[model samples]
Target: MTAVKIIKVLGTSEESWEDAAQAAVEEASQTVDDIHGVEVEDWTANVEGGAITSYKATVEIAFPVHESSGDA
Candidate 1:
């Protein structure tokens, strides 16, 4: 049996939604470990002058929790 945890994150990019999503995961990886997967919960974009200026993505990242073993 394994334990898993989920955390929500927001990422923004001027490129595309995919880049936003990927950015979230990449940023999370910097501090998090054992990352399993990611689920995009929502997406939004910033519009300026009738043009999209940035993309935002809300994602849920899943990872495994480390269990402690008695060693002392």
Candidate 2:
């Protein structure tokens, strides 16, 4: 059986939830490969002047951890 691993990340943006979510995936992609998917487990925002000033996204990024080839 293959081992599975999971990690949680919080990515925020002043724009929208999509951006916040994308931010997380993009960052994770830099180091983690073969990202299966990202789930918006939770979300919150900062309100200012009766409007959303910032958006925060709680994402569950799931991916497989593979052994490094070490063929540098």
Residue 54 in model 1: shift from native, Å?
0.2
Native-referenced Cα lDDT, model 2: 0.86
lDDT tens digits, residues 1-62, model 1? 99999999999999999999999999999999989999999999999999999999999999
Q: Local error of candidate 2 at 17, Å?
A: 0.8
lDDT on C-alpha atoms for all candidate structures: 0.97, 0.86
Candidate 2 displacement at residue 47 in angstroms: 1.0
- Per-candidate Cα RMSD to the true structure, in Å, reads 1.4, 2.3
Tell me the TM-score of model 2. Answer: 0.82
Instruction: List candidate 2 segments past 4 Å from native.
Output: 68-72
Pairs that collide, model 2: none
For candidate 2, write residues 1-72 as lDDT tens digits.
556567888889999988998888888889887889878988889998999998988899988878779999
Total backbone collisions for each predicted model? 0, 0
